[model samples]
Target: MSYKAIYTYAWDLQEAGVPAAVDEFRRLGLDTVTVAGSYHAGKFLRPRGTRGKVYFPEDGTVYFHADPARYGTIQPLANSLLAEGDVLGELTRSDMATNVWLVLLHNTRLGMAHPESVVRNAFGDPYFYNLCPSAPDARAYAVALASDVTERYPVSGISLEAPGWTPYAHGFHHEFALLKSNAWLENLLGLCFCEHCLASAERAGIDARRLKAQIASDIEAYLESGIDYPADMAEAFWRADLAGDFELQSFLDFRCGVVTSLVGEIRDAVRADATVSVIPSVARPTAGAWYEGSDLPALAQTAGIIEACFYEASAERVSADLFDLQRRLRGAGKLRGILRPSYPDLASKTEFLGAVQALRNGGVEEVAFYNWGFLPQDNLAWIGDAMRELG
Candidate 1:
């Protein structure tokens, strides 16, 4: 499986326009609702220069049907009409909201507490900063934290965004060292370098030395693709296409084993049957060979659905059908592709239609726009009718 050829399914959604949002979903004739992970208005409330208060409350608050303000409080599953498909706040049971997927921001309280639960390298230290799944403290924190979120919210799925497996994601090699083992401080300095990691790897017969070499190699791979390498690595991991080469299955096994352990624990603790999904950023080596080690086969092993992010305007740069072609390599029927509005301020109806037309023809079953917050209401009329007719 080289590139995951995606099937058109549905588009991303948000708690926009209240009841009108559902009407928009209907008008568009979309079948699925995709809520982004940690997309909230109350968050950071303001961007760099903005002064006015964020008009919409953070989606985390009521989107999950939970009172988002209180961290520990669990709201009653009060809304009888709330169904998973209601990406907007006011979903009714009668709306037939079905097959909705909510995106979750993944991280244990320990991730916040220890800050180092995520892997990082700062100064000259080679640290194990990633949340140590095998560690008792990490496990306890993960179980409690995930349980708290799901129990507090009314989500149908969890999207692991902040878990930071790739080592190239945001805050990669974050400067989060909590321990100061001289040997670890000198080397083996990442977050998971805690006592638990050493003991677990020893028990599992995982050669710590070998793991170190792999980390060095993988970090270099990330850097080769222009992704910043963690500070501690000796060399760069070569940048390759996220949609790998012929030996994809081997990498898939490793990815499945590695990522699955993290996600599986969350599902085991929170929603066991959570509809897990993956959406890799288009920022990395979309054009490179099998370097990023995406391993769609491996992703498929752990995920309920896999979505690849292709900016709506991508069609203009390449053939319109390229994204669909990418999806086709997966060979799995569960793969889906997502599209966002080309522009944040306003959408070009022509581009929307063209992209969708291309995606549909490319064998995709669904497409989604970013958020309702900025999408012009007038354009909503155009989208509703256009989307409904796609399938």
Candidate 2:
């Protein structure tokens, strides 16, 4: 049977009532409800929210009550709502199969508290929103978080998001910059030169100091020369540039190894009964996942499933993305494609159904919608219709 699910926030279900939300999910022909176990702050406009139309969650807080004893230098803060009730526990007790969606290593709140544990660029400026996976404390915290959730709740599985490095251009609140942005510049600035990363590179026989200096110098030259890299040439730029630089390619490969090992550790830490899947990268097309340290084949071997977010506008683009990802995975693991059924990705129900059809035709046995709160009631209907028609 094809597995169908919708990504949902814990707060949304809490307001809508757990039992009622489960009924809605079942009504939509979904087998599972992947709710947020831990999440970052976001100003979300909820179309089906009962509490309020606009909502902002507590920054970098877990929806479930976390075991304090399982943590170290970095820890997860429980959302204030947990004081009133256990939303996650309530959901697990319901009829729907529950999967905890964890946003790991992307908490700005923890990064701000433990500055030394966050990702630092070549210039030593910290990206406070992203915790460096190479840091021992950060790595321990991620594993502990996953283990804690699975241990506490009778969850079927856990989907790990942002378990590796994040890009520099990720939209943070009120983010403003005077300089022009491109894939080349963002990738250059996103290179982590933190002490942990440098030490890892050294152990791998790389000239860490020289590479750091070279990247810093390259950024300076690019800025001074006012080079305009066309957005369309992102893939071509990386191919040509990395092909010429053996050391740079090795450095990126080592970064992927860091992420892969961290994910493997998390997978081992979780209970054997609970499935451990990973959102390999937030990058579109997923082919540019190397910049965020995600190796698809390596991840497929480490985790149970690779939930590739194929967020494209057309069904053709969605099919093309699945084909590329399948070729890269080389049949190492299961693949689940995630789609955004609302505007900017799909304009009408027809387009949404077409995208779902494309994934099914591409040999995907499982598919998921982006989020419950973000979509209109019409979009929910689209999901139900698509599930019935496809099945």
Candidate 3:
């Protein structure tokens, strides 16, 4: 079943501006191409290229796009590369399956416009960069957006990334850089205390307010003083000897529930024939996995495919991570390994081939390259070589 694929930014297709890009994929011996459908709002610094704004489109989507009559406001970027070219059509014609990749809950546009739905820190600060999954508007928007892409395009599958909540430590800009590094403290500092989360915790019979106050106080103290607390504070806070808090554990469980529920909704929103795949972060057991609401077991129940990401790591490390994630998700469904064969990880063909072989041995049926645009032209043929060896 060798299902080899490559991920490409929509801008890459726009820049290439030729039907022959399909030929390039054919030469690489790739069977699938996943294109970025609706992405986050940011300024990406392309290689040797001018920076461009990544945003929600006014076209290509059946919903969530600009509609002056229905929304009373039209999004500025009405024309996009997806709507302008026949790239999707061409890829389909070339006998390659196309998947529309969607990023959820990471939109700065909606988060900034509707601050009410943004994630709130324990210190009462709102991170206007991340949309709250528990927010009704944000949930509805994500579902509608996923449905629109599947309904309007000829995509064979729907790939969901960042479908859950984000950490508070993100989007702090230069402030985050200046702070000291402490995994346990960073994890605690990343917790969210938004209104929706708080209300849900209350309904679940958990004292979210008390936990929030304690967290705020501890975090504030840690910031003010260089004194280090217990090394296992993040995980041990629930222990009887430490904080003896069961309600705090319940609060964490509530966050995971929110994420699981969102994945289920997105699965139902897409077309029945298309597969729903999710990408969750890879973290150590010492670091709580449910913090970002990425419960593999629960989410796997709703999703058809689990595209485990093992990016920016060595071949042996990628092998270890892929195997561990495979064990966790294997009982649920198929596994697709995503990798980066370019800088910071591999410098030669031996490393790339070793990684590909490791992925196959680790029970990965499909392997998707990190991206086509980020890697140089010379590095692409390695994909073909690996696929040939595997075949």
What does candidate 3's lDDT look like per residue over 137-178, in tens digits? 778777766776677566788788877766544553345456
What is the alpha-carbon RMSD of candidate 3 to the true structure? 4.2
Candidate 3 collision pairs: none
Output the better candidate (2/3) by TM-score: 2
**All candidates: CA RMSD (Å):** 9.5, 1.5, 4.2
* Top candidate when judged by TM-score against the true structure: 2
Candidate 2 — number of clashing residue pairs?
0
Q: Model 3: which ten-residue window has the lowest total lDDT? A: 67-76
lDDT tens readout by residue for model 2, 153-271:
99999999998898888836788878667877788788899999999898999887788899899888878986677886854776777889877888899999999999999999999
- Compute the lDDT for candidate 3: 0.69
Candidate 1 stretches with Cα past 4 Å from truth are 1-17, 36-110, 122-169, 172-256, 264-275, 280-294, 316-329, 344-347, 378-382, 388-391
